[model samples]
Target: MTSDIFAEWLKRQGHLVFKTKSSYWYSQAARTFQAFPYHRVIEPDNNEINEFLKEHNGVALRYSTPLSAKYGKISYHVLFTQSTYSIEGLPKKARHDVRNGFKKAGVEPISFERLAVEGWELRLDTLIRQGRVRAETQSAWVKQCRSAQDLPGFETWGALVEGKLVAALIAFSGDDCCSILYQQSATDYLRFGINNVLTLAFTNEVLKRSDVSQIFYGLHSLDAPDSVDEYKFRMRYTASPVRQRVVFNPRLSPLFNPLTYSALNAVHKLLPGNPTFAKAEGMLRFSLQGKKPLAEQDWPLGLLEQKESILKQY
Candidate 1:
């Protein structure tokens, strides 16, 4: 899809959209937003990116292009192609999960316009609490979802067992891609593997639509939990490493570099039960960064073009 279309979509969801010589930015508030450079067609020069970064004051800035590494460090994500959705292409375990999920019940497309907001909120809140999702993040998600429910081309689907909603999936459709924005399952029915079943059904439905080319599974870091990483791999999704940089305001650079963040993350992994430390670290990381623009630096100019060519094979 064109940057203009995407920008408009973000605006409909309540973000403030603005453009610069090298990038398009969308923000919901003063200290948070994401920037997408004009890199889909032409490479942006350092001056343009610098100018774009200088205008924003956020604790951390997220850049969405594959060229993120040139400015900072990289994070990888999974994007599924049509071939990856075929039953034969899935790993044995994943195939089994999908089959078992399907046997329980089928997924059906649902109109977000018809869903009761209060009911959806109760279900979402319960999922967040059970999954231990951060409260601030959960709040933001609920707000966004509520606002975007009636947007054009947005789709929501769910699976029911004994006439009760057990799992749900939400996606935004674009000209050439569909992004799975949110997927959740009821905590009480975790054993049913409803999430996997819903995903399989969604993939199948997307494949039938000739206009869609791929599915963006969202951002994933190499340092993510092992179970999460493994589940994606088992489902036959491949991680395409992107130059993802989280530009930290200069004031917070010393405490938020890749090395420091990685070390802190590793420590958290080792001490899984320490929510106190996790909460404290998250606050400190954002607080020390201040209200400066987070800029990604050191991008290799031609790497994104080369990577795109290579990715086309999948």
Candidate 2:
């Protein structure tokens, strides 16, 4: 997909994104604090990054994979291939849970041409408050979701029990890939494994499409919670390390060092209920300076190789 379209999508999702002469900016704000997830550079080089850093008063910019290693640090993500994945590929326990979930919920998955945005937002908000959904929601996000029905390649797949929506997946299809951008289910149905059922149903629907070969489930770090990581692993996603970059503001150097960041992160974990404080803490941690630069040559060639293997299997 073109950066222009992706940037527009980000805006539609309530992120403050804009294109610069040489890069795309994704500005994130929490309360009164502002930060950038990373600048997407058209032609990434040391000079371009330096220029961008200068423009942003030395705020760090994140880039993906190989280029990130050359210009920053390394991170990782789990990728799920839709073409070769099926319910049978999941772990026995996971498969059983999904099957049992459908039986218990007494509902079959349904594809929706469009779902009511306000209702969807209310369900999502309820899930978020219960900590079942990790994503933060804003008022603008709900407004954007309502407007997104007119956007190309955007779709929502949902499951209802006796006419009450229990689970939903918001997806976006690009030229060659389909991404599950957001997912939520009612907290009351967690025991019934509605999350698993929704995922399976959504994947099955995507598999029916002839245009997409891969499904991107966003990012997952090695240190991610066991519940989430294991769920994705059981669903047969392949993990690969991708590079990430951070450039700290020189004036705030002391507060943005690794040691300080780790300590603050510990404190932040204790204050989960205070999102404004948590977000401020995250900004400091994200802007921390790495002790050493990652090696550039160690790009995850295995990710590409794995993708090729999956294609061959198909």
Candidate 3:
């Protein structure tokens, strides 16, 4: 549940781990350092950032920050922070689907090893459905699932239909929060509302624990479609406003200025479905947008209630 355990899990899988004054970070694609415990909202001061960058040389650091942060892009985190959760608390449509999903599938915790062997096809179907088959190959997926087999704080839950795994999710429980890392379902069973059932099941289980205060679904994607988070919203999760900052080293920071962002923004259009260009454009756009005054920044529309408590920290 501690940051140390999370870092150890990633380290065992050969990911480079960095411990900072506030959080644990891991090097991911394109030499970017992603802060983890994914629920934790960290606001790294300039001194901490400079120290880390000096040690790492060239790398980008991305993490969720408070909405009142002076620097960083406005972003949203998908989270369920209700004091209590139940099927009755869900909306009419979600309530109906969750009930049906339960009738059609049995939801329970499964061994990570079992998930590794039986969850491959589920992962493939999910990637294909999301048009992101390039995200992970079969071998890579197998290794990822198997790597968490004996890791503490990590649990795998699955929804089974007549003994066949139809949907599954991997969640990490921290001292006061539980983060859902991955969820995949059989596309053919979408009509059965299996994924809804799985989300509801795990979310409820986490909430039942007196020590847990929230269930973090994940951060809103910078490159993907809005429909991705829309589904979570429909499942009764709210869009928790936060600033997502992308920090580059001193030497490389200039390359991501307004000129470069505009050029890449235009380039991504001609490139069609290029994820790299798409993400770069997003990062630059956020950085630029974050610099504006608070009122000038666009809010999450209806996704967030702009109350003083949620908008301003003070």
Candidate 4:
């Protein structure tokens, strides 16, 4: 039988095998979807995985943490970035506070307003310059931003340096909390501590008045794990577990509830360093080494890349 035919036969026999290359397959000998979650597959390294995940703030954060079988831990993170309680009396006063902070440091707070389109565009460029993202992936990100903008509760804000964009953030406001999706700042401005200023401004303006009780920093993985977490932590934010589960059934599951529960139990019996325990580790490697630009042919749907080129370069 041809390799395809043989592989099909194995699949039919309830053996779990995955494609390694164009035509080759290998087996872990499992049958249920709840048995293997593709997202949990360890391929690349942890750094790269974290970088790739930075673009999709939630997903990266979701899988970056240590996994547990407890139903409450399925989601790895959550925040008040999505609350819609109407930050009434705080943000209006941000300009004054930012200015005060700047003045205290013998600097001026350069103000700027960034629409979603411009914000994403600038973010793509920032990623490329930093080498966290390749040019092609930035293009795909632009398209994603356009779609995400129309969704309810999406917002972004930033501070400027001498009329040049220095720091910015993207977030979602919901009924109770806000989910900070992405944030960036120019390297040169790091010494100025613009990130702290930006966070304080965002909280005072948006979170404080929006009636939003908390700010969710998304996920805390090995890569830049503490970068955002540290900032939010100082702002009186506390970590809360948002649980997630990966399930594998040969067939796509319409409902993953029961099987997900089973998979969690099975995973718990396993220890750290088991093949699955290294998903983020493998993904991190892929993101770091696979610094290749996205092919144009994969536009609008290509996965994001993660690398340390820019950090290394500087």
TM-score of each: 0.70, 0.73, 0.91, 0.45
The TM-score obtained by model 4 is: 0.45
Local accuracy of candidate 4 as per-residue lDDT tens digits, 98-210: 44446433223221233334555556545554434432344444544454444456566766665656677766655455667677666556556566567766765664464
Worst 10 residues of 3 by lDDT: 299-308
Each candidate's lDDT (Cα)?
0.57, 0.57, 0.80, 0.42
Task: Assess candidate 2 and give its lDDT.
Answer: 0.57
**lDDT: which candidate is best?**
3
Once model 3 is optimally superposed onto the true structure by TM-score, how far is the C-alpha of residue 310 displaced, in angstroms? Answer: 5.9
Number of backbone collisions per candidate: 7, 3, 0, 52
For lDDT, candidate 2 versus 3, the one ahead is 3
Residue pairs of candidate 1 with colliding backbone atoms:
68-243, 69-243, 70-298, 70-299, 71-296, 71-297, 247-294
- lDDT over C-alpha atoms for residue 24 of model 2: 65
lDDT (10s digit) by residue, model 2, range 85-200: 56788888888878878886543433433354434654565546455344445555466556556667877777677777777777777756787766666767777777788777
On TM-score, who's better, 2 or 4?
2
lDDT assessment of candidate 4: 0.42
RMSD values for the candidates in order, in angstroms, are 7.1, 6.3, 2.3, 18.0
Clashes of 1: 7
- Tens-digit lDDT string for candidate 1 (78-139): 67775446666777877777777777767898656433342365356544644444433544
* CA displacement after TM-score superposition, residue 22 of candidate 1 (Å): 4.0
How does residue 241 of candidate 2 score in lDDT?
51
